[model samples]
Target: MNTLSILPFFRRLAGTCRLASALLAGALTLPAAADALPLEKIALPPGFTIELLARVPNARQMALSPQGVLYVGSMRAGKVHALPLDRDYRPGKLRVVADDLKLPVGVAWRDGSLYVSAVDRILRLDGIDARLDDPPAPAVVRDDLPKETHHGWKFIAFGPDGWLYVPVGAPCNICEPDPERYATILRMRPDGSQLQTFARGVRNTVGFDWHPASGALWFTDNGRDWLGDDRPPDELNHAPKPGLHFGYPYCHGDAIADPEFGRKRACDEFTPPAQNLGPHVAALGMRFYTGSQFPAQYRNQVFIAEHGSWNRGRKIGYRVSVVTLAGDRAVSYAPFASGWLQDESAWGRPADVLVLPDGSLLVSDDQAGAIYRIRYAGERKASGIPQ
Candidate 1:
């Protein structure tokens, strides 16, 4: 469909449903536009400011093209959007790139094509950035992925090795399924050839990135639930090379044995997490800071979006977190931006984060159906840190 046709459809959808705001309690006001929300409610560290980049319904993952067009995907909304940005990297016109897709939660840009993952299939829109106003029909890249809806949505990215990496989660909360099909990260050439499993024994990984200097893979794995609030913490795992298996059905954080499957295998047989995050933090989309916008200390640090916990009695996450690394080891993990969850109520949930070329960061909140831009505006002292 053309931009004109899809623009009206979104306006109608936005006017009647208010998809994101409806999830909140009755007390919260329904912001017609993202700007209507009280921005001060979101708390950030000193010298940083956040603003609404765009109001994208069910915005789950984002990809930016070389020509400055941002493509966003949706999970439940079954749609993909493209927003052309101006010279300031601010969004200009919004257009629907594709719709009627199934759980299209991941998007990636490479070599003038925009790749979208819809559960079982990967579709590509060719020359998408140059034709946002009138996008062409999507061509299939791959369609043989597992179709299980349980934890089936994927996050895809091109690694430093020039291969496309995709993860497949276990179909159940915790079970040993077909090793070749589930609980693994797979990589393939751009044309969807030479598919091979990269990492195994992963429960569910929604985000991953290669280290800036080392080029090793790091990912966030959501821990299996129903183990109480503090039992199995989510994980930040490192896979320096292929054939690494992260403990999943058998073991959890720091070699904690699983109640059912732990007896089958020893915890020490598999790789352990580099850093154990909060229990059920649902950490997603992470990126290594390669821009000079922040302090020098943050140059190679990793920033994560914690989607927050739902089953835990006391909620955690719903914030942007940072993991400081010291030569491949995580030295510290802390909150960078929070305030989404207050007094057991949350109005937004962060799903993904992206670092722009200009050093600003973009965060996508699926619950709020909006994208937020975070920029470092503080002055740095002689110590090379923010004052």
Candidate 2:
């Protein structure tokens, strides 16, 4: 065949190969439109690129240890996972460290042990890094949490003050639950002693992290459902001290009072959100950008995984977003990566975000059962502020 005739043949072959690759990547989970390296559909800022790192079923919260093991927690899968990273920061084979537990969606590593949060208790795997192939049976650290399954899954982490922070979500959608217990963020030592309420009036907080510079705690709070599509906004909250209430059950967002419970107290009775997010966006798993791989402008900013809205008529979120902070206030909140939802059909749901030591970002998608790495591959500069 002449050169012109063969050109069309090569193009057809290339397209066929691409389609097959996408199907094989997510055949078990996502639709064919969002598989393999369909990352092309994903949008990021200039100089940034995203690639697949690993696949972990039901990946929720993520914690990276000093030795390069990335521990992930799950809810529906009821398991805890460990993914080792090579020196170049690529993910190795995944290992399920623990399985068949109740909503084990929180994992934190301290010293040499891996701490996991089940529905009603906290468990620990001693020396978990040294026993990936044959992890020891989890030992119960504390087992006195509430037994209610509604909003029971947790996202846990170690604070700067050496306390393991765990959130106990309200058992119901909206109610006058005891502030001392339900709708509270609790903190305890590694041995699960001296447990006390860190913050109150949190309906359901699935993610939190201390500020890199000031050590102030910040978190994402999901708004109550049935409040209509645009009534109450999901919150990015700032809790620098204990006993601050973020206005759950009685108030929401900056000053939107709860209709059923707001009569008991004014909206000013509690602390307001640092930034008001989209209504019913289901924001979860946030981290501060403290690495050097990205530009200096990204330092100390917040990275959030919006798992997307299931209740809204027009779907929103389903992407990783960045919140720029000036001092203690959020100056801007914008999308860092998006396009998981296309034509009202979502193929991937971003569950959590983690910053690697090399400064690349890791995003976990429970719906797609995959983890993706976002890296800066172009010339780096620190001149412009994020608009």
Candidate 3:
């Protein structure tokens, strides 16, 4: 064959090789998007539909405003995003509200002010509702928080008592810390006055909600990792009153004695969890369903986002679970929404769950950088529009 003919054949072979390489790269990237990690896969009951609402990178915790705006905080990005929702709970526009902070992981809105938790500071923006399109300068409400990066980011909320509750997590996986450091929950005035320890011996609790009927506090605690796959399950605790202790370091999930912190004390000395969630589940945001859109059974049920596990050999806890509260204790548990983690080899980590004013559920997935909306279609809506 002539030289020109050979040149064309070689060119075709090179193009074919490039195409094959591109396909391989895409194949490797697809699983991370397709498979659900513990927090990303939520299993809802029948008749409820869950759809991806927004995709946010490294979302850690979320807060919803009274006007129905969804604000999300990110750990890796060190930023907060405001996601606007339409009538159907679908995200309409996503805007970066603030950025370049020190690992902002939590966000809250109260009285038109926005409060955000950075690693070593609690910052707030006044008249946040008026500046939704243009975030004003943030003022430091409280500083001098411990500089330890691990578990330093916080979930901040203004409880019914008008006190701001902040959780300081243990810096290390397991260690006795200075009195000012982790394993405790603290409450203070909105102006950072009258700081008091509300609860102690709590390793790390990222999500909490006040009881609708009783005004008590409830939170989720993550168990220590590398303690086998089944021992020391995570916890869902209730603080009927302040100064309560949910055993950490000394005890774990229900009555399981910690191998590291247990010595001469009995697990009964500390208040046990309302229920044991699971081992290494990394439970994050939680909310109580008090809306009327769902059936009567869903009222007062607790919904939690399990962020899943990384240290375990086999994956677990990539979905949201509901805890049925019977008076003071959890009677039973079941999955609410799932399908985020597509397979055992893949992962999509969910971080937070928020309920909107319209009685819809919004779930934030950090790994996949997406938020999902779950809503119940009533009989009238389920059927075609009335003729």
Candidate 4:
């Protein structure tokens, strides 16, 4: 059946309950004509092109398998979607890898296993790609995670060190959370062993990536809201080593003291952000451009998805930005993708960005429930360069 025909059945089969009710509410908040949406609505640079990769409800935090299958984890839908791709990068087919999950938001594949993070627990499915149609029963890798529904959904990634990194966001807009709760980055073994706090005071960093050259962990932190339109800016931070602190609650932006959490402590206690990504720009997933297809200037720069803002009177973000670095310092910033928010009154939210093997970038827009592929066609080279 066509995707449109299958959506209604899926919606009914999803059952009528509180979670389903919430999903319905969220769906209603979306644009009325979701199918008519085009990539042009999401602005990008001149030479770059955007195409819808797939349509999956509430898709976020993507992970790709070795064979190039895109695995998407959902927040409101409580399922993981496996999207099949042809050799040319066209989305060929799609299937539900796992369902009935409790607001699963993070997904990762490692060592022949798939890891999923829900609000209160972490689950593992061994040999996932081999059993995409009928995934095996999951094993609880870890439980007792924070149960707070708001801002508790995770974005998990397996670092180069073979440890799983997870973000625990502050449950509220701006508050001094419990010690075990928000504003921290946690790392643990694949089996949920050796849990440790890698960084502290990081407020709602939904996306992060390890620098390919320096191995330092760089993350994008969303600033606290309700503080007006442009006081405290969102941050792009670089943690050169573990145990570092990226200020939050107590301090924000460069050295602006928090209106609520500010105390006698010195702002110098924490490492300031490498760059200030404009105020209220709900920055999410980040990835270093390591692919060779883009211009040489694009290499190693950080691409961040700014999910945009709501609480502010004048909205910002809603587009992706590139953060350039020079020897561990943010040298410059520029917009890589735009138009997601349209006229500041309208809406489209980009949640994540992933670099494929072919040097193309795949961006996920959760508000529209679509994934867009972006590729750079060199202006210097013509369309038909004779071999």
TM of each candidate vs. truth? 0.89, 0.89, 0.85, 0.87
C-alpha RMSD (angstroms) for model 4: 8.0
Q: lDDT (0-100) at residue 219 of candidate 3?
A: 94
Clashes of each: 0, 0, 20, 1
Writing each residue's lDDT as its tens digit, candidate 3 over 1-387 gives 688879988999999998789878754334434434243244557667666566677887888887767889988898898877666565666788888998898898888888899977888878876677899988898897888888887888889898888999999898777645678888888877788899998989999999889889999998888779887788899999987778778888778787876884689999999988878878888989888888889898899998888788777788888999998889987777655567775456778888777888878888877777678973221211111
Tens-digit lDDT track for model 4 on 244-286? 8777778888798887777845688878989998888888989
Clashing pairs in 4: 43-338
Candidate 3 least-lDDT 10 residues: 378-387
Superposed on all Cα atoms, the candidates' RMSDs to the truth, in angstroms, are: 8.5, 7.8, 5.7, 8.0
Report the backbone clash tally of model 2. 0
4-113: candidate 1 lDDT, tens digit per residue: 87998889889667655565644454455423545567778778888778878898888988888888998999999998887898678779999999999999988999
Give a tens-digit lDDT track for model 2, residues 1-387. Answer: 589989989999999998788778844445433446466788888898777787788999998889999999998999999999989886787899999999998999899999999989999999999899999999999999998999999899999999999999999989999889899999999999999999999999998988998999999999999989886888999999998988889998888888899999898889999999888889999999989989888999999999999988899989999999999999999999998989998989999999998899999999988788888988322211111
Off by over 4 Å in 4: 1-34, 378-387
Clashes of 3: 20
**lDDT scores of the candidates, listed in order:** 0.89, 0.89, 0.80, 0.83
Residue 23 lDDT in model 4? 68
